[model samples]
Target: MQNFLDDNFLLHNDIAEDLFHNYAKSQPIIDYHNHLSPQEVAENKKFENLTQAWLYGDHYKWRAMRANGIDEHYITGQASDKEKFLKWAETVPYTVRNPLYHWTHLELQRYFGITELLSPKTAENIYEQASAQLQAETHSTRDLLQQMNVKVICTTDDPIDSLIHHQTFAQEQSSFQMFPAFRPDKAMQTEQPQVFNTYIDKLAEVSNREISDFQTYLDALKARHDFFATQGCCVSDHGLSHLYADDYTEDEVAQIFQKIRKQELITTEECNKFKSAMLVYFAEWDHEKGWVQQYHVGAFRNTNSRKFNELGADTGWDSIGDFKQGEALVRFLDRLDKENKLAKTILYNLNAVDNDLFAAMTGNFNDGSVVGKIQFGSAWWFHDQLDGMTKQINALSNIGLISRFIGMLTDSRSFLSFPRHEYFRRLLCNIFAEDIQKGLIPNDIPWIGSMIADICYHNAKNYFPFNDSAV
Candidate 1:
């Protein structure tokens, strides 16, 4: 029987092992999208303990712990860090088939050199060892990223952000690079008039502009976008339940914005129209600046109202949403393509049911201006695990060019999450090897290995304008 997490962990064949070890393993990572803190990296922050480094702000572990009936205190409340970690250790054994099981051990082994499985039995010893290492200078945030061979990290940022951390990081000489990704979701969020106005006020303050009208608001946001470019941002991201493509004129959208500014509640139809207009404006700006625009859609967030009120959003209360994506998605892209304003776009769907729909959609607007310009992004959020990754890859391979595919990202807040890229690479190599064994593909190691290397790193390097000397 195969040993758990052995050298050939996810590699199922001899060819798979060879491809991973030789081609995929050594490629430097370009984590194109993630929620990592730029401040931590800039400061080179070291954790006081394993829990602070692992469990803090990690909703994935919180969700698992909650499933195991862990109390709120141990999960996210006022419990001591050690007590929280102990609870997590007690719950780890029950995570048998979950990806967290594999990820927990992989992180321990890779970062702390601990090969023992985590459980109640080993928790104390493991925690002590890892915590001690975390306190070391070599285990600081920057050092951890270096150890993982991460070449670039693009952190999510609000348009109102000063990007002071990114600026600070840029001044230092480091092997890896960090850049900001402009995420302007709040700029168009009109669901709550008070909240939207508050955000607009912040935007106005940051951009040093007056926002008396919709035109002025756009001017302020555009100024922020320009400032983000100065700080080396070349990517933009959006989080949405689904694409909005409602047909509305500029005058109507302006009036909706005015109502929002006056702290008046707009109807749902107006909200959708405003969002649709904002998306088009953002996409046009991205195209003008030669930036890549990403949309992560189909998430039904904050389902637990009580918990959301107590803990706020992104505390693991979100789930995959079933939304009608086809028509709106097509209309949105078609609108941009028709105007020649479509940026290099990546669409990530949280729901697995739309895997084929998303994969096939990319084909409609390739235009050959760029290779794989309209990409179905890597499996995201709830779909970032083994089964989900495989399904996404299979769908993309069947309908799109997997060779041109930019590969895995952590999409996580933890420094230790870089191991997810390794997991993805191994799975990818194994898939190709299995096809060769089945005589479905040629046994051309050199050719297939090149493709693997591209998917692992090179594709992203070329696709993103990261190496632009002007930046």
Candidate 2:
């Protein structure tokens, strides 16, 4: 049998190997969307141990560990770091068919140069070696990023954020730039009146204005948007259950906002109207500033109230949502396109069933201003694995121009996660190689390899307005 994780780990043929090695592997990553801490980059913090680096804050690992019947103490509970790691080691082999299996070994191999499969017997040595390396200055957060050839990172941030860490990186002229992407999810969360009001208070403090009315609220958010623009932010991201395009008059939205400010409970219809208005307003600002807007839709979050109450959100309690998407999504885009107010947009659906729908939906509004004006985004969240990526790539290739597709993002909270980009590249190159080998396409390696390189790097470099040269 073939050895585990050799140089040709995901490559199945000669052409696939060559394409990945020559074209895809060495391309600098532009992770245009992620949740990495900018503060960690600025401070260049060293991970204290393997667990701190690998386990802590990684809900992906937590989910897998739980699936393997590992206990809470070994995950996010009171166990020591080494104990938690040992538990993870015992769970790794059991994850054989899961994406976690590949991701685990890839991260270990890429970051620590450990080719041996992780198991209970090997965990101690591996942990010692990696933890020792992590303690070194050369393996600090910033150094880790540099070693991985990460060119630019756009961290998801609330509009009210000061972006001080990003400013710090800019002032120092660091090798890699960390720009913030505007995520105004809290701004549109009118259902949680008290929480939203608290957020507004913070926004008011940052903007030096009171938000007593809907117009004032919009003005406050616009001020933050302009502030973000000044900091080289060219992207806006929304994490939504689904697209919202409920019809409402300006007066209705105004009244809704007023009622919310008073902490009154709004009906589902009213909530949708308010959210819809905010979405359009955000899109308008994006268009006005020539920025790209990305929507991550259909996440049914906080499913386990018991777990959510104990651990909070993004702690592995979320799952794919089956919300009705087409009507509202189409209406939203059409509303913007008809008015010539739609920005360069990317749509990501957590539910893979919507892959074809999103692909076709994007086609309806590519109004010739840009080559790929509207894009079906890469597979995200629950769909970032091999099967999901293949489906997304094929769907885009079938119905849209995959040539102009801006590719993968980490969307991870770990410094060690950049290897995921390499994972995607290998999978991508393998697909093209197979297509060429099967006589489905020309036996032209060079032409196909160029396309691979574009998907891996050039497409994103050309698509985003972020200054890569500055980094």
Candidate 3:
């Protein structure tokens, strides 16, 4: 019998085990960046069963199920819990080398102690066991976080959110630390005038300021940014199809704002200009606040407009978008760096080729104050698989230094996803071991393992705001 968690199991050397897990004090996982629901954490909700816990909110699984010829009725529809679980089980066997396969099995092993491989044959029995465990207090939301040694978690949030649950999480100080990241993507729109106006009104109410135009909108956003700072927020997040670098003047933006309110459509070029200006302004604010900024680029969100209108955001409709990302990203980053406005930053891209782009970009901005100051963030969105992580790690090793890479974020909406950290850890150890064994890397077990642990857990503590300790 082999322990999936055995340190040397993946790396295949008894000596490596002692190095990696030595002081493996996973007391709490500071999930610096994720998309978890604050309301769920606040209530400490226990899942009804496996389907409710695993499938209810996961867009990743939903997309795969849809791709494998399953229907909406069976997925996110009125199918029995057992039926949905069976469908997912059928899909699991197909997920093979995909990150989903590793994540599913690792979580099953970690939380339920069920090591039997998931397949159509074992679906019913496995589902019954998992459902039973998922119903227990040990499998409660907060406990699930605790099971993964997650001590702190930061949830991605929009500018207009009430943050009531964030306040609640702090007041109670549950095992998982829930902080907020200021994501302001919707504010940069030149499309959808009606939605923008409604959003502006909501933003004004949240920040207690009235917005008449562009300047006022910026002011309201600034006020909210300041408020987030007053609490414990130390990161801001942005998501885009690609980087925008079109320069625009304030006067030009003024007219755009007017058209925006009147529900007039702006040209794509003009929209790019406005969005570019907005993103730069946001970078300035992040710099002023000394906050880390995260950029997740290259997602073609909502490709299937028909399904989008029916199921809403993050159903199976989103796919990877192709765009020339490197040049514009350079312009935007260089613009910030030249002004000394670059904060501690993380760059993520869905496309794997950009791994080199991100790694090389980090070198462009390391002004010697910090070693690897700007990080190429964890493999994110569609690219968080073992292969993706390997590509990212290899790119970093070849271009930048992997030892300095701050690695592995769950980026998931599920608490069951904590096993992803382990999956990343194993992959990391194996990469290093293979390198050492092949004489590609030095055979220094203790030093290599220490570096591996740092990548797995230690480095993130210093990389993120774990030292704030306000909660």
What are the TM-scores, per candidate, against the unseen true structure?
0.99, 0.98, 0.94
- How displaced is residue 54 in candidate 1, in Å? 0.2
- Per-residue accuracy of model 2 over 1-471 as CA lDDT, tens digit each: 556778887898999999999989999899999999989988889999999988888988899999999989889999999999999999999989788899999988888888889999999999999999999877899988988899899999999989998888778866788889999999999878899889989999999998889999999999999999999999999999999999989999999988988899999999999999999999999999999999999999999999999989889999999999999998999999999999999999899998999999999999888878898999998888999999999999999998889999999999989988998998998898898889998988788889888988888888888774743
Off by over 4 Å in 1: 468-471
Q: Which residue pairs collide, candidate 1?
A: none
Q: Write one digit per residue (lDDT tens) for candidate 3, span 1-471.
A: 666444354556644454445623352456778888888898888888898888887998987888788888889998998888899998888877666777788788889998888999999888989989878888888889888888678889888887888888778856557788999998886588888888888999988887888899899999988888776788999989998998889999888888888888888877888899899999999888778899999898888888889889877787788888988988998999898898888888888977888899889888898666799888887878878888988998999988887778888888788877776776777677777878887888767867876776667777666445632
Error of 1 at 59 (Å): 0.6
Q: For every model in order, what is the number of clashing pairs?
A: 0, 0, 3
Best by lDDT: 1
Among these predicted structures, which one has the highest TM-score? 1
Q: Each model's RMSD to truth, in Å? A: 1.1, 1.1, 2.2
The worst-scoring run of ten residues by lDDT in candidate 3 lies at: 19-28
- Backbone clash tally (model 1): 0
lDDT of 1 by residue, 1-471 (tens): 779999999999899999999999999999989999999999999999999999999999999999999999999999999999999999999999999999999999899999999999999999999999999988999999999998899999999999999999999899899999999998988999999999999998999979999899989989999999999899999999999999999999889988988889999999999999999999999999999999999999999999999999889999999999999999999999999999999999999999999999999999998988989999998888899999999999999999999999999999999999999999999999999999999999999999999999888888998875321
Model 1 poorest 10 in a row by lDDT: 462-471
